[model samples]
Target chain A: MRSLSVPSSPVRDLLALTSRPEVISFAGGLPAPELFDLDGLRAAADRALTRRTLQYAPTEGDADLREQVAARLTARGLPTRPDELLITTGSQQALTLVVTALLEPGSVVAVEEPTYLAALQCFHLAGARVVAVPGDERGIDPVALAEVVERDRPELLYLVPTFANPTGRTLDAERRAEVLRVAERSGLRVLEDDPYSELRYRGDAVPALAASSDLVLHLGTFSKIGAPGLRVGWLRAPEELMPALVVTKQAADLHTSAFDQAVVADYLRESDLDAHVRRLCATYRERRDALVGALAAVLPEGAVRTDPDGGMFVWVRLPGEVDAAVVLRRALERDVAFVPGASFYAGEPDRATMRLSFTTGAPEVIREGVRRLGEVL
Target chain B: MRSLSVPSSPVRDLLALTSRPEVISFAGGLPAPELFDLDGLRAAADRALTRRTLQYAPTEGDADLREQVAARLTARGLPTRPDELLITTGSQQALTLVVTALLEPGSVVAVEEPTYLAALQCFHLAGARVVAVPGDERGIDPVALAEVVERDRPELLYLVPTFANPTGRTLDAERRAEVLRVAERSGLRVLEDDPYSELRYRGDAVPALAASSDLVLHLGTFSKIGAPGLRVGWLRAPEELMPALVVTKQAADLHTSAFDQAVVADYLRESDLDAHVRRLCATYRERRDALVGALAAVLPEGAVRTDPDGGMFVWVRLPGEVDAAVVLRRALERDVAFVPGASFYAGEPDRATMRLSFTTGAPEVIREGVRRLGEVL
Candidate 1:
């Protein structure tokens, strides 16, 4: 009875390893502060300082904000209704609500190998066992996912189709269509977490898998583009699923902060969120390019790194003889940090792999951090 | 699978009954708009609109806000550490995190006969069966609670010991001690939810039940006194429970909005929150008096209402022949609304009971709403 019913994060115990202030972290998926639109926030705050903005808002969200989100989705070729969207504390709570409503104890869920640790945590807490499907640099392997679906008949499959965490891989359009087709055939509900879609550093915009499949639950967030401090995010699901999601949300946090929602709504209504997103893409691309170039110049010949089209991270594979955990410790002594690849795995940990975030620090800092890592190696 | 997993809210389902624009709603547990210090909010926004305020913050919350919460608790004689407190989206999220950690399938929980509906919803969603203990007008009856505890030995007992929802009842100091003793003897963790503690319309302040027992988890909110739009709340628990709550919160919403936390911390630091509380007390007291007076003049001779010292609601018992739900429907038809008693109870609802909220509307609105309700009756 003393033990919690929810499973505790094993990563928390290992948190002590990276807690020192001197540790220059690439471990966390934190957005760059310089990329945040501070001037826009100030302007938004000025608008929200009105008496009406301080009042309680509709639980669904402010209608104008929902419409803004809908418009953004529409621009991306995914038509959405205000009623189909539920604003959450963050995309994390969106997952929490979806999992709470759709999952039961011992329910089977399929996740990509080296998935987002936080999503894995949510699924584990909901009493679901995660089945890892083999994925490659091109994102989830459709054949492997189909095999798992045939074998386990999982209730749901979760994926970050664009700019995946810990891997920094995006599914090609053909793979996206195949994954959607397989899910539809197997009757699997797909949770498409797309927090990084707008942060694309290169390439043409890809249509969401949700646009191709009615069963897909699409998640979006303000964390990557704007500020994580606001904790504003949303989920778009089928109409049949909206009521349950709302109820689960009510049980979770009643609703996201109304004041934050109002500020965001005002910002979206009056400002150029797209232009802000363009700035994020431009700055992050430079940082990404710098990190990639620095790794090429500094790392040993056999070391390999992911070439991400967009988003914050660069997943690197070190020499098999050198464990990432060991490298992380040595790097931290040189005042640098990265997430060990093991933190992202559902079962089998890849000791030689690690995730480095390139978006949080400046290009010069990234170069210096990589040079230090090279020295440690 | 869809039907079994999603537990619908009966209250929210019935919200359509009072959805008309003309309705003077006593159904919502919202604070009055006039009571909001717009001037203070404007000042706070101005101060918090800087570049630093728009950046990401620690998941636990900003240090200054945590210090302010600790100070407020210390002044109340409840010793709290800044680390022990995790700022939540609201006290609602505080309860959600507690339930997510503590409850599993078939777990037994105890509640007052007519408890806060949201708590019941949360517990139910967490896969717990709530057993109601008979409570008198003064709050959870110590004798009945002890008997239920002896028989059931539930995992936790949730109660609003001060100015409780649906009942507007406060537990006396002696009863609070008795509850603590009973809980300790029975090994039942007590969740003391006290959102309305600062809204005392009359009498001196009573120490929270958490002050009497180390096992008690205290939930406090800024919604009643300051602004619900900010959605800031806190929980103080024993050291052992802090880790589990924090971990659960990490999965639920990452953390409450950091911007809101900074604004609240800034507001509290620069101004006397006590002064604002005094204003709320004065405004709400006038509204309460108006409702009480109107009920006396308009209600039937057999009608009875609790005389609450503080808080938003006044629980009323109409003639046994008159069903509150039916009367609520009639009242809504006449452009007035309230929560019917049936929504509050987990087992058999008292058909004669209803809850009238006095804090959201003005004195004139309250008077008119009560008159309309009386006319319908």
Candidate 2:
């Protein structure tokens, strides 16, 4: 048989470095299942198993679920209609649809430096050049973004305004408005990814960047709040973009699973998702405090760690000479794991930084893991 | 906000003309949901709910279901391993992974002239130009494929080997082997789409082209036999290609819904899927026969219809002057529907052809729809 050279994913090459069994991966931006509403999901699935719910549903999504999502977003102060919402396989697929519909080969997309790796991968696959804007713990630096927007004339900018992956930082409300204003002035559309917004452990809820920007494409998912197993997520875009997204989604997976949608809808209807969110906040806050306290106590002086108010991750910067990738291997030898900070950057990766997740392990496990990390250091 | 002009899907312009509610959509290659195993699905969902199977599962799929799918394939004389399979949101996403991982911008792909529209959409989205090879009712003509292979030196050939969409055509054993041989000699990879393979209403089972071609990436789905709403499908690729696919899938939706995968796995293990297939065949056979019989009785003198041994669709060609799109509008005006032929082609679609799906509606509905179509003619 002849050997045809198949093209490979640019992102896939990085995956092999992180796929070891002994690696306690903080690399994957996966929701910790210990925090999932398994009881509610079970009840919802039981309810959905009835004869009426087992058949094919509308390709758009189950009507009741779409309405619930819309209502929830409306309550969050965003103007949304049920018809405007599209349920997707995940927020990941939603991003894929956005990229597929709005991006062409060689299109310029401005993203946050050290943004979500998956989003970067999606844009790369869609044949877009990912131009990064410098961001801090408060999210995208409006001045830097404005400079890049004026310089590169990018078509879109992607950001996570609340508790971003790899860096558990939220963009402040002032910066949010500034970013929106800049986008309005510069003609750049923003893709506001807010999956970690609901998992906030401290402070009051902040309005999403989408609420402020008319040009924003808001992506949300149930993966963090409820269950990742269902792979249910939604996108709320402007009228002009919805049709294109629908068509792109139709060509992607027909639509998200109807069974999963129906079950999630049923779960939302009967359960107090807000209350579940509160419980998640309490538990994750405890875990977060444990890790932060342990790191402070165990790590050497000058090993800076991000003090995130909420979300699953903590970004840490080590001494300039200590590469995180090498540290990760040493930590694994001591039976601990984390994602190297270099994996998160679009262009110039930081070898001295790493991300630690507080959601996956228990408080006891967190302490032990940190102690092991201290020994490695 | 400034209107951003990103390059759109080339097929998007064509989609507007095709999505009219009044059009008899032979354009959408949707499975006949009437044949789905709703009872078994309901039972499985109920059982899974009781077992609390709504939590996150391994990214590959639920273990029992993978084992069951493997066992079932093995029973059919095809060797498979549970680890070798990756459950996808649908066969569409499965194909998307293959395209994303293998095709680069401007890569050459060979496809059937009248291919599955979604496959064309996928390849186009991946930034590859599709070269069409002429095909007859028995699937892609091997001699024509060989000629195209020699001329274009394409990277991949995509085909629907059994009960193909829009055509309801199956490749005989000899043709299957010949096509595999051609692919081997030419060093071309083949993507064998077999979603409709199990919906056969008559005749003995034909060996899959994958069994013959080691280069084949075989895709299977539960939509035709089980439920489209479940969105459960699997792709069997060679070991060398599996990692890239897994990485692509991880970037796509993390994985297909673990809840849905669990239910499907449980359903496949606990229920008699073969018995369900038998039931589907019996009902669909009647529906297919109804449309075939009605067309024989009512079609215009010069019109020709396919006599498919199995599958839900029957392709029909009208007289030279009659365009199927016009006929479709007229049929829908009379409260009937079918898809126009032009939507299926990757290049120039046949304006004189149309496809009628018999299994989506009842025999009486099928007869009435065909009668209205004939009247329009």
Candidate 3:
């Protein structure tokens, strides 16, 4: 118990490899720097600071940020009230709060075979027994999830249904409905982590699982859209969960940055988020295709790649018994980096798998990075 | 267990009461808004946003902020190394991380009998058995702490030695030394929470426990000096505890806001924090005296108050069997608000005690606010 850790996040380890100026990193799920609303955010920061907004905020968050977050979700077809939301440091903190409030030590938590690695870290730290439910290119398989619920009786099912981290897979509408039905019937809590839905380039936007299920705890973040630097996010949970979540959030950091929240609120109020997202979608879309096409053209014939419709990553299953660490080591020498997919699994992982993010680099850089990775392989 | 809260922080509850425009609130230990280095911070924000400082910072914090924090401590006689520190979302999170890393369920923690109420909540949520060591205006009794250490075999002792919350007490040099000696001898870790140390008004500053003891974990925050709304804080822990704390912080919020930290670093680099603090002290000192004098003139006989040298609140012990809740109810009727001291205790609390902050109001407002409370009494 003394050597306690929330498991070493191997994805962050992957990010460390990108320190050199020559490194074209596909390892981190960073947004394109060029797409950031820097000028707008600068003005927003100026507005926030001048209002003497440097005092402590309410534990829930600044009211305007809450309303802005609520409005954004409402625009995305999820009816949300300001009272129903709790602003978090990021969705990362919202995840931490939800788990701390809802899960006891050694509680059973079910997750997709490959899910957000950071969420896995949070669960592991809380001493939750995480059972992986098998998933495919289109997100977690509903039948497998049902089986896990039947066998393990998990208290919670954590999902990243729309453009999930690592996989970049969006759960189809039918699967979303079935999963929600299973959760509602079983009285199991479902966490709908939706950080990437709005960054879509091609596919039709699927309504969030939270929209359909009362059991769903929806997490949304400005990290991907506004700026990760501000560290702002929100959780839309059932009223029942609010008390515990609030208490947990209060202890975690007292509150997220009121100054940052005010800046975000100002930015959200004044700027065109949809237009900005569309631009991000366009930029990330080209980079996504470049990596997929490059991996297809460069890697061996037996290598399988999931061509994601949108979002940050392309999941690759390299041919044969290839070790990710070895490939990563070789890739680093050539100034190219991608996270080993083994890092995403709850237990035993496929050593052959890798996650390549396209959001951090240009299309040509993506092609070059992939070409370098192919040479290393 | 389901209604999990760190503890019910009445200070936050007090802030909620301040929403009414007519209420003269002395319930929260908030800073003077007018004293904030707003112009400097505005420039810092401009500089921060200009440098593309809107990216995920290193888990510990931005390098420059850590160095600045370290340098500030070095000036205060604590030889802090940049590597020894982990920047937190505020010292609140520093506490959360330290407890998460060091404590297990049912772990014994010895705290000052009316220590920070929110610390109790964090300990409670972590399932720690918080044993109280009796304290007075001179701060926690070191002899009582040693006795608790002997009988309870507690793993940690949490103290706010200088300008402690609720009591507005400063532990003397001899007491600080004795406490450190006992803690080191007992192999009990000491958490020296020092948010208000820099807000000195009347007395000479006390050197921190961490400066004298290797067993100490020091927490410092910019909230009291720089800005609470920014929510930046740091932990100076022994290298042995760094790993677990780092992991806990990573799982907690990934890291404190880089954008905020960068702004703070820039502000620290550019401005004189000492000058700002001196101004704060000058402002608060006058208000503090006003409240103390007003209470003397207005309160019923037998009411006792601590005339603090520094920090925010003045703890008042109301006459006889006066229920604090009742006094607060009546105080609200007169549009005067303060925290009933009953909210600060771990078990059954002192109903006759109250805490009033002089930091928020001007001298006239403080005098008027105290008069209204006197009328209510």
Candidate 4:
């Protein structure tokens, strides 16, 4: 039999490297284990593993979790109903299901240049033609997005509107409204991903375009806020899209774990998630400042890094003469690891750029890691 | 911009009905909740929710859980390595991954005449051309399978070799050998779904065909033996297919929950799973006998039922005039439920057939439920 072929995800391979004890890794966007509310989670799990929780749950997910998620959305000003939300294993599954259910083979889907690597992979796996629209530090370039959508005539535009992966960029409220108008005018669906908006340390919350636009599909996850090991996330789209997504989810996996959902729901009710998230923001802000602060002292010349308002990552563009992958190899020699930015782009890649996650390490570790990275350079 | 469309899975809707307390549900292939080793699982969960378990796990799975699974496989006469196993959200996800990695749009996949409805939905989602091969009481008809493979030249053959779904049919030693020989000679890849093999009540345990065949891709789950709510399952396949499968899984959801994996791994280590399964087998055996004994008295003159060697279901062909769907509708009025058989077929459906699961009820409940079903008939 002939072997089927698919490219290995560069980020996934980098995740494998983090297990090496010597490596101070910024390769994976993992949450800090020390910060997890384990005591709260244990109590939640204890209360949730009853007879009702042991049975198979609905395809959409546990009703209590869905309602809780909807309430969270409402708390953020994007009011939603339990029935309108589809619970997922994580936001990744929500994105994958949304893409799979909507896009067909050869269907064009426009994405921001150097976007979340996994989203690009999901779109590619759907057999969609991925068109890249250039973006600045703020977020997707609206002019570029409008032009690309008009020219490519893509079915959907995938965007990480708030605290985007790899870049840690957040679009302003005015730009979000403009993008929504553009999407409506261009007849393009917008996937508004907002996993890290809640982790803000130095910025006002920008309401999601999904709150105002019918064309936007909103995605949120508890991985950053609550516990990643629970593997809980949700998607809020228009009522019409739920059936197709639910059907696809049924085919993918009957449903996410019921007991896990119950545990998360229990935690949401009994624990101080708001305070816990605030604590996460406070800790991550220090780590982010330390890493960004070190970059200036470390880099030689012609290298620039984004100063994110809040999130897990800081994106750096290396000097033109140096390749990020090559630098990564050298950095590993000094036991520092970061993901090269080549894999995130839909079209021509920024081979001289890299993404460093500040989530796994503390301020001191971050400083030392950046110093080691500087030594390699 | 435009609304996408996808058909709802029939069984998914059917599963929704089982939540009503008044309904005696034989519709869902659920394990007996009372049989769930809750005390053991609690101890395991307590042991597992450490700092490491709260962090992200390898995409392949927990090394310890994989080793445990491999050891279990060895006990079944199919010695596997930890590297060969990939943990999934459930066995459903395993099937989805196998189909996603192996089959493309319009790829041919051979299935049994009446197979697991979810598998059919998965094949359809992959845009596959499914061809059904006829089967007898024991298992798939070898001659028919050979003809279909020659004609359809399918990329894969999905089988439930031990305790097949819907039919509750097991391939006898001779038939299994012949089927394996045919598969080898024809170069047909086999997906052996053996979720219910461990639940045997009154028969000799047949060594899996996967133990001998290189073409076989084996799937297993903890849902039946340990708990369904945990949503832990795994697959063992040739190394060649692992990369593509892993890539798809990465894009789907980073990985299964690390805490769930650790919990199951701890349970495997600390609990007497062998004794627990034996207890399950003994309990289910009585239920099976009650249901089978009642079915003979309940069904009409021409109706017939297959006595499963092991598994949750007893497949019954009702009287010619009675439609299974109609019977289901009527039975629900009397607070009893069984899945109609039509959706299980790839081609022409058996409208007069139905499947009753014996796993959810005890002997008394099974007898009473069956007698109530008889009244409706």
* Position B303, candidate 4: lDDT: 89
lDDT of 4 by residue, A1-377 (tens): 32457888877778777879988999989889999988999888888878777767788999899988888889989989999899999888999898888888899999888899889889888788999988887788889888987798999998887888889888888788878888999778899888898899896888888898889999998888987877889999888889989988888778998888999888888888899999999999898898999988998788889889988989999877578999999989889999998988889888998999998898889889999998987
TM-score of chain B of each: 0.96, 0.91, 0.97, 0.98
Tens-digit lDDT string for candidate 3 (A106-196): 8999999888899998998888999999999778999999999999999999999888888888899998999988998899999999888
Clashes of each: 0, 5, 2, 0
Local accuracy by lDDT, each model: 0.84, 0.79, 0.87, 0.88
Residues B227-319 of candidate 1 have per-residue lDDT tens digits of 888889998888888777878888888778888888889888887889999988998899899988888998788888987999999899897
As for lDDT, the candidate ahead, 2 or 3, is: 3
Ten consecutive residues with minimal summed lDDT in candidate 1 chain B?
B50-59
lDDT of 3 by residue, B203-293 (tens): 6778888999889999999999989999999999998788788888888888888899999999999988889888888888899889888
CA lDDT, candidate 4, residue A219: 92
CA deviation > 4 Å runs, candidate 1: A5-22, B2-7, B13-19, B50-52
Misplaced by over 4 Å in model 4 are A1-3, B1-4
DockQ of each: 0.61, 0.41, 0.65, 0.64
Per-prediction TM-score: 0.97, 0.91, 0.98, 0.98
* Superposed model 2: Cα runs more than 4 Å off: A1-29, A50-59, B1-35, B49-59
Give the C-alpha miss distance for residue A68 in model 3, angstroms.
Answer: 1.6
Evaluated at residue B335, the lDDT of candidate 3 is 96
Residue A287 in model 4: shift from native, Å? 1.0
DockQ of candidate 4 relative to the true structure:
0.64
Model 3 global lDDT (CA atoms, 0 to 1)? 0.87
Instruction: Write model 1 residue lDDT over A1-377, tens digit each, in one string.
Output: 43654445645544554457666667767787766788788788777765455655556776777998898898889999888899988888899889989998799999999899988988887779899998898899999999999998999999998999978999999899999889989779999999998989889989998898889999999888888888899999998888788888878777788888878888888889889898888889998999899899877768888989998889988876778988887888898988888878887888899898888778888888888998987
